[model samples]
Target: MTVPTAVLLARDDVTIRRFAERDADVRRWTELDRGGAYLALEAPELLAADVRAFFGPLASA
Candidate 1:
């Protein structure tokens, strides 16, 4: 079960663990709003910042 467009990782284990705990809720929310999912749950700029924050190190390295 993977969201191809979603890169959800954190620099620390705790953050990853916490986010992992909410995986089910996110999935349910996505399912509940199929139309929103199709259109993207967040705006492009917000999503770019989030992905950059999560994968900054990888990108720089």
Candidate 2:
């Protein structure tokens, strides 16, 4: 699924950012290592860290 970043940026009511799983494939396998689409299930702590990083500043606002 492609995000319309240009269209989204043209809107004034939203803030957006993109996170790319560069090593992940459609089936969620990592190209260079053992990882799957079930990241939250496989790596809860890592997922939590990324989520916190994304929203942490907003919480402080």
Candidate 3:
């Protein structure tokens, strides 16, 4: 089957990492598949918020 249609709606790496480091499947997390869950939550506004959340801090950094 083809890859599922999903987007971060968000793509903040640190956030994604934090999430994965949390209750996520630590050992096999995204090994066989990429961050499909992140991909699955796609929405235009959320993606924008994610971008802003990341870049806002990055802009200062």
Candidate 4:
């Protein structure tokens, strides 16, 4: 079985993840929703901040 990279990266468990401010409005933003999956969520700003904090090193590198 071969799973696509997009599938591997797409967030599955929402329990530990959320959407970013600039991306929260995206319909099925994740690869998991590729087939016309749409969704909306609140508090996207926090998610964005958290993402920055977590991946800041990569950007600087």
Candidate 5:
């Protein structure tokens, strides 16, 4: 599915971030080598950074 479809699936009250893997197939979705499907498990630091980035603005507001 496209990014738009994924965003639409989220709750209206939620904010979504779209990130496409640099080496992923053009027709499929793939995660980074260091953090694939299990983002938090494979790369907790990166995942936490992303989560913070996504919500940081809201927290300041």
Candidate 6:
């Protein structure tokens, strides 16, 4: 599969991480994933804010 398709369709964290490890260009997604996970554990309110910022517009749809 193509990199864009793989990145867009990936839902499993392990799969995403593997892709990131194999592809330097897609590494930011992995970084974001890790940052999000860390925020979830260490600062849930911040995570909530990020979720809102990232998904709030979609909520209207």
Candidate 1 clashing pairs? Answer: none
RMSD value for candidate 3:
12.5
Ten residues in a row with the worst lDDT in model 3? 1-10
Put down candidate 2 lDDT per residue, 1-61, tens digits, no spaces: 4321111121122322323323222222112132345655666665565556555655676
Estimate, for each residue in 1-61, the C-alpha lDDT of model 1 and write its tens digit. Answer: 3542333432221234346545633321111211233223544454456566555655665
What is residue 32's positional error in candidate 2, in angstroms? 10
**lDDT, model 4:** 0.34
Best by TM-score: 5
- In order of TM-score, best first, we have 5, 2, 6, 3, 1, 4
Local accuracy of candidate 3 as per-residue lDDT tens digits, 1-61: 2322122322343345555445443322222122334543544454555456545754575
In candidate 2, what residue range of length 10 has the lowest lDDT sum? 3-12
C-alpha-based local distance difference test score of model 6? 0.43
Instruction: Report how far residue 13 has shifted in candidate 2, in Å.
Output: 29
lDDT of 5 by residue, 1-61 (tens): 3231111111122222334323232232223335455655766776666556555655676
Could you give me the TM-score of model 6 versus the true structure? 0.35
Candidate number achieving the greatest lDDT relative to the actual structure? 6
Give candidate 3's error at residue 60 in angstroms.
0.8
- In model 4, the worst 10-residue window by lDDT is 1-10
Model 2: pairs clashing at backbone N, Cα or C within 3 Å = none
Error of 3 at 19 (Å): 13
Alpha-carbon lDDT, every model: 0.39, 0.37, 0.40, 0.34, 0.40, 0.43
TM-scores vs. true structure, each candidate: 0.32, 0.41, 0.33, 0.31, 0.43, 0.35
For candidate 4, what is the TM-score?
0.31
Q: List the residue pairs that clash in candidate 3.
A: 6-39, 7-39
User: What is the number of residue pairs that collide in model 5?
Assistant: 0
lDDT head-to-head 2 vs 4, winner: 2
